[model samples]
Target: LWLPGMGAAYATAAPADPVPWRAILASWTASHVAHAVDAAAERLQADGKRAHSSQRLTQARLRQTLQRAESARTVRERRSGERQRLLAAHAAWREETHQP
Candidate 1:
């Protein structure tokens, strides 16, 4: 296999700046931790977006329900008024027909 830092005679590292094992391990650990933090942040952001959407949907449903209730109340009031009018008419007719 053709390795970048190896020579034809022996397989040895030949980087101009020799890095200690501790330094290499520390850098690797830091890189992994940074990646983990970034992943967690992304998940948190997605969760926030989902929560916002859920709140909006819930509010919209509540508004629709409120509107329906109001409309039902209006219809009920109108029907009640009609019944009162009919009762008044019936009373007037009774008085006129059965005159004392």
Candidate 2:
């Protein structure tokens, strides 16, 4: 009689229900989804930074090219003005010397 009661007590002490499989699967799926979303957001942020840097570099190069063009124009104007002055001096000298 004491043995039967001891077996009955042991049986009641432990659970009879098995472990749930669906709960485990659901938890794993949710974790993966969250991880993927975070990775995509990080990638998008990096791409935006790269795009901003590229635009700044392009603008700087454009400004540099414009400055060079302006400098070239000033140099050409000075050279043209000097050439005109030299021509005028030569003409005046020729008038005074009078080659016959």
Q: Superpose all Cα atoms of candidate 2 onto the true structure and report the RMSD in Å to 1 decimal.
A: 12.3
lDDT: worst 10-residue window of model 2: 1-10
Question: What tens-digit string does per-residue lDDT give for candidate 2 at 38-83?
Answer: 9999999999999999999999999999999999999999999999
Write model 1 residue lDDT over 10-61, tens digit each, in one string.
Answer: 3232344364444445555566678899999999999999999999999999
Scored against the true structure, residue 8 in model 1 reaches a CA lDDT of 27
> What is candidate 2's TM-score against the reference?
0.71
Give the alpha-carbon lDDT of every model.
0.74, 0.72
Report the lDDT of model 2 for residue 45.
97
What TM-score does each of the candidates earn? Answer: 0.74, 0.71
Q: Which runs in model 2 stand beyond 4 Å of their true positions?
A: 1-19
Please report the TM-score between candidate 1 and the true structure. 0.74
Best by lDDT: 1
